[model samples]
Target chain A: MTLILEYPNTQLKECLIEELQLQCTSWRFAVEANNLSPWNRIPEECANYIKDYMTGKGYQFDLDRVSNEAEIYARSVELKGDGKDAWIFDVDETLLSNLPYYAEHGHGLEIFDCMKFDEWVENGIAPAIKSSLKLYEEVLSLGFKVILLTGRSERHRNITTYNLIKVGFHDWDKLILRNPEDLKKTATLYKSQKRDEMIEEGYRILGNSGDQWSDLLGSSISDRSFKLPNPMYYIP
Target chain B: MTLILEYPNTQLKECLIEELQLQCTSWRFAVEANNLSPWNRIPEECANYIKDYMTGKGYQFDLDRVSNEAEIYARSVELKGDGKDAWIFDVDETLLSNLPYYAEHGHGLEIFDCMKFDEWVENGIAPAIKSSLKLYEEVLSLGFKVILLTGRSERHRNITTYNLIKVGFHDWDKLILRNPEDLKKTATLYKSQKRDEMIEEGYRILGNSGDQWSDLLGSSISDRSFKLPNPMYYIP
Candidate 1:
């Protein structure tokens, strides 16, 4: 009886292990390769942890790290003195934080509330992340022309400009928000095209910084790209 | 002229706001509720961040949290002194973590290499989760019988048994592994049946703990269930 049981168990064990091994291999691929579906929600613990970072010193440290990188790159660039040395900065989360809005509304842990966020935008009370602000000052002193490029619509340009200056940003060579007709373009496409235009206009984009991957992945990517941590959300 | 220029832009802005608002609501439901595709992989950042936790203090804190809950419940239970009072524990990541296996192989961040993992398993060197170990001892002293149920197949019984005892788990009244013939059963179905059998045998399962939701959510569930975090992978 024991032998009969042992015989089948041995065979089954081998098969089961093989199957489990295969399953493990596939799981590795999915995770490492980012092969997940777009519609899937971020896990709750992860979402909350990200929110915590935003509320805590962790977020500032990350911004500081990005700023440090920006400063190093800025210091190394030799200015042409022809208004051709440029740096692109994404507006939301990269310069001004959206923490207060996110803190009340789930910080990307829940679905976005556009009307609510739009109202928050209109309030325009977002404070500058001190690190980014410091970097902004450093770059301007280094003679790198700062160009503000954001996904916010052109309709909000007046308010966006107000907020930028209110938060201590000054003298950006250009502040380019998305045009009404540019709404159809993905952030990457729109931003990439804009960078291409800058290059055509003889401006050398020395560096670009943003909180989203889409902000940095397209054509005319700068000599250096700094990604500030923004686990709150992903923009396509 | 000013009103005409503003009219078209205002109408478009309202239309855009309406569309964006709808998208936001759907995002909230999906994220906060974990309404995601089963087949989808975890987001890469989340996966890597979880791996960071496994190697850092986050995992220990989670294990500590589970143990704390277990201790409070264990202390409150008054066992009837009948060998019938029991607690169930799912083996992997509940008592012994596969973190070491995952750490060397991308911590579930990369594709699972089955043969490599199986080789790791064969080494029988998995260490006990300290928090779970404390809880294991606490319940044993509380006069509740311990039953270990794992999805690992019967063929692995020798090594599995060795690993458990080596990892500070001792004197479990029963250690149940899936039989070769039981390979066709779903984890929920198979485990539920085993739990039913325990019920038939008069085992009063006061508590159960597992890393997988499946391990806790079926027929014959215990009076209370504790879930230890395991973001590395999911079991069907």
Candidate 2:
């Protein structure tokens, strides 16, 4: 079955914008107002509008039927450590927003300009997704390990790692990247191979978080995998 | 991009059968003959005949390619135990011949013909692949691990395990079978999961010998996977 994401129409978008102004208490309102709340109290018009918006963009927010329990469990195992699962997170579109870059221009295939992307990373510019960043810090405070696995080649690893540190993802176990030659294969395979090697070295991967499937599928060792929302369109 | 297996024809098959008779000094004729002489040395008529026979029977005697180095390394790791990566072989069509049963009776899809299949698995019925069996024994003598993984359900595990012992695959560290509930997934995944679990439990999967992809693919933890020629076809 094809799963479809739904979003509100222009009218509902306007209403939500108004609601945002009314509930301007904190950044939490922005998140809560973004259709994450229970739909019981939500007006039909807003719900329909949100559904239409999501469907148009091909984003299926709800994945109830996708029973990836086995895959999830496998991912979680890779993250678990010291009796607590440690997570390695990818920043851009995983924990941070590339939206500023997208918004400054437009939303489409042409949105990603490599030079601009590099500049953003070099400048340590992207802002973290507050909700997920909060979750990341919570996991860290609770003594879970957090590492970063990225596709930004080694050339960009330093800047990317620094950006993560600037944004408060501290004490990372490792920051991994694709070996230049191995880029010929899918990034998922490369990451998975590295994760498997880590497993061989005696690390029980308890959990992994990423915005793309490649970040999760390659690890032969992870137990649980959590995918954060990515409104921006980078899938590599 | 399509990798096809090419086989020798019928006349060449008859000639090879005759050659087999003449070269039957040891069970090593298959490997030795294929390695020692070029196919071009055979008469044109004989070559064409063998090619036709092989192609007609869907046999690609010499076309299989091993292209992935990562896969090779993984296989090697699975097989190389500190003298523990002996040979964990599967039974039906792997070590013993099952053609007689299929030839005399009908195929496996008709119904539950337990008696017929059971008689085939019963002791002293089928002969081992002499050359491969010799290799297995040689590896065993070197003091490696030997563990069998099979698609046979747990209910039949006892009987299947016993049959292997009777047929001379002695001294196994473990005999694993498909749990009844896990039957829904492909045998390859089942075997792979079991093998991974074993690897996690500290047993290095050195080598796996199987007649089907399911058997070979299951143990991603293994170092090397060897496929034995299966004259008979019964893979589940």
Separate DockQ for every predicted complex: 0.01, 0.01
Q: Which candidate is the best by lDDT?
A: 1
lDDT for every model?
A: 0.74, 0.51
Report the C-alpha lDDT of model 2 over B1-236, residue by residue, as the tens digit: 12222234656777867554322211111211111111112323333332332233222221121112112333334344454453466766666655556545332223436576765665445655444455556556556666777766677766676656566777667777778788787776787787777767766666666655457643453445555433223343
lDDT per residue as tens, model 2, A26-55: 111112112121112223234433333223
Candidate 1 at A175: error in angstroms? 0.7
- For candidate 1, give the lDDT of residue A69: 59
Evaluate model 1: give its lDDT: 0.74
Off by over 4 Å in 2: A1-85, A231-236, B1-236
lDDT of 2: 0.51
